[model samples]
Every structure is written in structure tokens, then in C-alpha cells.
Target: MTLLRHTSKEIKDRSALTINPAKTCQPVGAMYAALGIHGCLPHSHGSQGCCAYHRTMLTRHYKEPVYAGTSSFTEGASVFGGQANLLQAFQNIFEIYDPEVVAVHSTCLSETIGDDMPQIADKAVKEGKVPEGKVVVTASTPSYVGSHVTGFANMVQGMVKGLATKKDKKNGKINVIPGFVEPSDMGEIKRLCKLMDVPIILFPDTDGVLNGPLTGKHKMFPDGGVTVEELRDTANSMGTLALGEWGSSLAAKYLDSTHKVPCQILGLPLGLTATDSFIDALRKMAGKSVPAEISFERGQLVDVMKDYHQYLYRRKVALAGDPDQLIALTEFLVSLDMIPAHIVTGTPGKKFEERIREITKDVPYKVNVKVEGDMFMLHQWIKNDPVDLLIGNTYMKYIARDEDIPLVRHGLPILDRVGHQYFPTVGYKGGLRLLEKILDAILTRKDRDDPETSFELAL
Candidate 1:
């Protein structure tokens, strides 16, 4: 047998670019995140394929029917203009979907030709298309410029900037920016805020909409999300809490700058430290003590950590996904004594560098971090220096398979896995979720590698 050694010299330049992008297209992530809002219809201002693909991916991931529309851009629309198609789409969607709020986000093709989305939105309103209380919002997301994380930020900002209104302040009301988290994560945030007796508003809230129960009747529109009333009143909130570093920055900054809404930025409520910090921020802002019920949750989370300590200790992991998710998950992995050897995110932004450094300062191994790119280079990095495991979405499965490292599926566009959409990845429950997957991956790898003679029934 020939010796096999991984080398940078053999790491092709195309790999330097992107062999397989870890993040989905900008428009899709924006649409997916938007669909979490209640009574909101997310429309793609590009080819029908873009909208269809996005809805399909979300439907599979959430195991629920996702509602969205396309401008139905054809060759003529591409060359001449998409303004007509978009206006028609707006008309048709309102007639059919009839959502209380319409959110329009653009793709690279539309953004490239310099399609002015906000202008088109204004024109649509001029024609008496959109209703008074039922508002319209738009986000410009050129796929070539940034990753899904950027798209999410753009969409969320559109919601706040376009919809938020200046009004009298609400003493108890708060804004919660959970960042590009799963539907279950959204649910947990709301639950925790309720327990703390803090009135909170989560923009693009997807918990009820995405993870809705399979009632005998299937409604095209799901019921869970931050209502239009909430969005309108969010400007009056006493404070805003952004969950992750990147996801929450735009909403926080926009509210603070535009409406003078006070904002607090924190890490995603993933691991213990991050979650505790998030809770403390909320408690102080609400002027309420951490309730005994939540204290019990912290204790339970610690108990789970202790129970799973042996399985997780020093389990080297490589992660690649959206930037905010990568940073949050990296910190969580390190919390479990797991070495995050390689990290990558497709979202392009300067913010990721600072966030990664701040979180990984205590990491035993300095993780190779990349932001605003694809997974192609990430796979190359893993091939060069193999890790014990991989923690990312379905796109990285081949890398794990080739390297013989068991992979745990997480993050957006999880095509190969299900149930995560309804399963909270925040709070104490999220720790249990992480522990279950980590142990299974490690044990499965051992089962595959152990010799028959030496392999025991149980480790």
C-alpha cells in the first residue's frame, strides 16, 4: 500500500475558491429566515427556481410547507427588466397568499442589473397594491457579495427600518434578535423571556410558523411569529437583545441609530456561559431577578454537562456554516472540551474576525477560521489536517466520509436531517440535543473502526 500524506501543495487553487459552498445562496437564507414571521409572505425577486428551491429546502428542513413566491423572472425579465414581473408577483401573491405582511428580498441576478428593490416597492404601493396596516419590506442581497448570514442581516434590517414606527415608549416591552437560529431556538428564546417576566419581541420569529403542529387541516399560513403589531411597536421598546454577534448587529445598530432604541449585543444562547450571559442581560434590562424556574434549568444544564463530560472531552471537531452560527457553535464546542480545529463560514463580513477571536481566546488549539466564502477551501483545510469529527450541515458530509470522521448535521439547509427544526438548540434542552448527536457520532465511528476481536459490546 502506498503512504498517504495530506499536503498544501496538492490543495488545488479551485479549492482555494470554493469546491462546495457551505452556505446557501443569499436570497434563500433571507427567505427562510423571513418565513418564520407570522402572517408574513416572503417573496423572491428573481427566477422562479430561486423561490422554489428555497421553499423546497425549508419544507424539507422543517418538515412543514413553506410559503413564498417568485417574480417569475424569465429571459425577457432578465434582459429588459424584472420590475413588471415583480409588480405582477406582488399583485398575485396578495390575491392568493394574502399575508398580513409582504417581505421582498432580491438575488444576485436582480442585484447585478442594479434593480432598485426599494424603488419597485414604492411603485407597487403607489399603484394601491399593498394595504395600509399590512406593510411591505425589502432586503437587497446579492449572492456574490456575501453569505446567508449577510442576507439574514439585510432582511432583518429591512423589517426594522421599513416597518418600525416611532411611538410612545413601552416600559416592559423588549426586542429579541435571535439571529439565524433554528425554529426551535426561536421558541426557546420566547419561552425564556416569558419566564423572566420580560415582554419581548422576536423579529422574523419562526417557531410557530415553521414547527406548527400537523393539525387535521393544513393551513397555508402558520400562526407563530412576531405579529405586525409587534414590529410597529418594537421602536418603542425599552431595549433590544441581539442573540449572536453577527446576526443581531444590524437590528441593534439600526434601532439604536434610527429610532434611538437601546440595544445589547451578546453571543447566541448556545452553551452555559453564553446562555447565562444572555439571561443576565434580560433580567437586568427587565429589572427582574432570574426566576427560580430558570435557575432550575441552569442546574439541569450543568447536570447534563457533567454527565456527558467524558464523551465530549477533547473530541476534535471541524465546523463550517453561517458566520454567526460558526462563532456560537465554536464557543459551545470549546465549552465541552472539544477542540474545534477547523472553522469556516460563507458569510463575508469584518465582524466575524473579532467575534471569533473573542470567543476562541481560551481554545486549546487555535482554529483555522474563514468567513465570507464557501466550503471548498474548508474541505481542503480538513484534508490537509484531519480532525476527529465534523460539525456542520449536509454539505460537509462528503468531507467527513472521505476523512473517516463522523459528522453531526447542524445549521440551516440541513437537507439530510430532520427534527432539528422543532428541537431547540438553545437553553438547557439544546445541550441535551448536542450531547445526543456528539455521543452517537463518536460511538458510531468507534463501532466502524474497532477490530472484531477487540471490539466490546459497550465501551
Candidate 2:
């Protein structure tokens, strides 16, 4: 029997349960965000198992070694609170790892016990667990609450609150929070900004940290990531451009409110429209015209879209991923005249559904959209009304195989494939890569299904 053979074609209303959830726990996202900081150690205030699982998830996804500390909560610590364990963790992390910053995030156990992260972190400092010039930041990321996307946002907000401070004068630079994208995407964003000659401070930038070269020597803290100085100087930047609403907005809003740094919250630059908005925002903020190089890249992407219209037009696609990425992707699909038949995200937000509906309102067919939904529901939808292409993480492959649909892995936890950490899916060039992938999937399917006599060697 197939993996999804039990999936019913009749979609039933489900609440209070999520099978094969589209999102992971919060600690994973927190750990990923913390790794974007230079010389930083992510500490989990919960069971050792939780920390290990979080590390393993990231390590598998990025195909790199991931290091994190845990409170090692036993039965006793779980009831009496893990405060002692956390303080000792701080002492050991500072003494052993010697990281510049210790980013502490809470798990389900710690959050359920109502442990106060701020108080414990302060206690660690008072007890000299944190050495002089070293910093400690804390974020509450309970698994029972929102998904990993929420945890990412919370940790970013923690970074801003703990480090950012206003200076005497503006630095005439921009602060960019790249959201929960791959290191390649972050690098692409930097490249676009550099092309426009705009100075930007991108925090939690994991470009070099996660996607380091295969040198003979191994360094615990790779020489990538945003330095402590840059994070502190974010307040002095002239403005801020937050990339994703869920992952980057909290930190930007905090900076705007606390330090008077003006911010513009935009979607992740995944496809053409989103990239255009990002470039335009950069152009306006920097008071510079759109450079010819960027214009040329945009033209290339447009040319390809026009050239391949026949292959992509009116092909139905089903998507499951984070809200920000899905929004931009949905818009991109619509621009290609492809129908987003069904879309689901585990993150809870009515606005996501509303925005998706608005984007696909003019499509020929009615779209099925859901927030706080699971993959099981998506499979059910696909069973009832099938799609030609499926886009999401590696987990979606099961549904793709069982339903005989082509899959394009695009989001987090893509363990079965590589190159996402090296090749971007954002910006104009990134859009070209994405278009190529979509075309490849569609054409490959056609080659597999079409008769030999009808198969064209030129297409």
C-alpha cells in the first residue's frame, strides 16, 4: 500500500489535531536564528533530547555540523524548574565554548514550568557566569505555541532587544533581516544591495557560517555571521528593510519603536514581483536609480517567462510551506498563469489565507487555502482535486509519489537534496533558477508520460 493510501478523498473538518504537521517545533527555528550571529552558541533551556533533536534537524538539512547546549532536564529538574541547570549551562558554555554571545531559547518543558528566562539570564550575569564583554540573549519559544516560523521571529526580536542601541548620529546604512531563508538567498540579497551600492547591516546572516567551504581544518565557530558590532550599530542605520512578515517583522518593529529606526516590512524576495519590490525599496531608500545590471537580470527573467509560457500556463500546483514564502510563490505562480489549486501552512494566521485568496481571486478555478493546517489535509485536498506540481520540503515527496505528481523541493528541512545552501531561490537570478526547476519538473513529467512517437527531442 502507498504511504497516503489511507488519505481520504472526502476532506473532513479537523480541529485540535495535526497529523504530519507542515511545521516543526520552535527550538529548531531559534537555533537557526542564533547561528546567524558571529561566535554565538545557541542554548536550549530544556531536555537534552530536545536540544539534540533540534541540532540533528539543522545538521541534516544544511549538511553541516550543528552545535548547541542543553539544560539536560531530568525528572527532578522538570518539576523543580531548570533554573540551576540553565545557570550551570551558562557557566559551562562560557567556560568551554567561550562564545561571544549565548543565545538562550526555551522549549516546551521550560515554558510549561513558567520559567522566567530574563530573570535566570540576569542571575547568570550577576553570578559572573557571563564574562565581561560577552552577552546573553533569551527568547521564549514554546513548542506548544506557534510553529518554527514564530520561534524564528521571537529569537530575532530577542537579538534586537538585547543588542541594538541608538548612536549619536545616523550611519547612512540599511539594516536587513533576511528572514528564515537559506544562506544562498541571504548572499543573493547582499549581492543585490551591493550592486545598488547600498550599505546594509544584515543580522543573523548565516552565509559563511552555514555554507562554509570544505577546508582541511574545522572551526567550531566559522568566520561567517553578523558581528556583535554590526548588531549594535543597527540602531544607527538610516532605515531598515525587513524581508519576511513572520520571520523579520518583529525585530524591525522593535527597532523602529525603541530606537526610532524607520522600517519597511516586505515579503521574502522569492519570485519576480517580490524581488522587484525589494530592489525598488532599496533604490528608494538609497536614493539611487535602479542600476543597469539589475535591470538586465530582470529582463532576462522576463524573457525566459515569455519563452516558456506554453509549458507553465494553467498548470495546477499545490504548495505547503511557511506563510511568507508561500505568499511570494503564489504571486509568482499567478504571474506565470499557473493555478495554485491548494495551499496550506501550519502557521496560524487568518491574514495568510486572506492574502492568498486575494492573490488567486481571479484564477479560473476556486482555490483551497488553509492556515494552521497539516500535510494530511493537503493530501486529502490533492486526492480530491489533483495538481500537476507539488512544492514544499522533502516531506512532501511522499504525497507526490503516491499521487504521481512532480515535486519541487523549495523550503526548509530538505534533507533528500543539496545545493539550496549554495544556490539562491531569491532575486532575479534566483527567479531564473526557480523557473528552470519548474520547467525541468514539468518537462520531465511530460517525457515520462508521453508516447514515444509524440515525444519531441527539441522541447
Candidate 2 backbone overlaps, count: 0
Task: List candidate 1 segments past 4 Å from native.
Answer: 1-9, 13-16, 447-459
lDDT tens per residue, model 1, 81-180: 8999888888887887788878999998898777898999899889978766567889998888666777888888888888889886564688999988
Q: Please report, in order, the local distance difference test score of every candidate based on alpha carbons.
A: 0.81, 0.93
TM-scores, one per candidate: 0.92, 0.99
TM for candidate 1 is 0.92
Across 299-409, the per-residue lDDT of candidate 2 in tens digits comes to 999999999999999999999999999998999999999999999999887899999999998999999998998899999999889999999999999999999999999
- lDDT agreement of model 2 with the native: 0.93
Question: Roughly what TM-score does model 2 have, to 2 decimal places?
Answer: 0.99
Clashes per candidate, residues 3 or more apart or on different chains: 4, 0
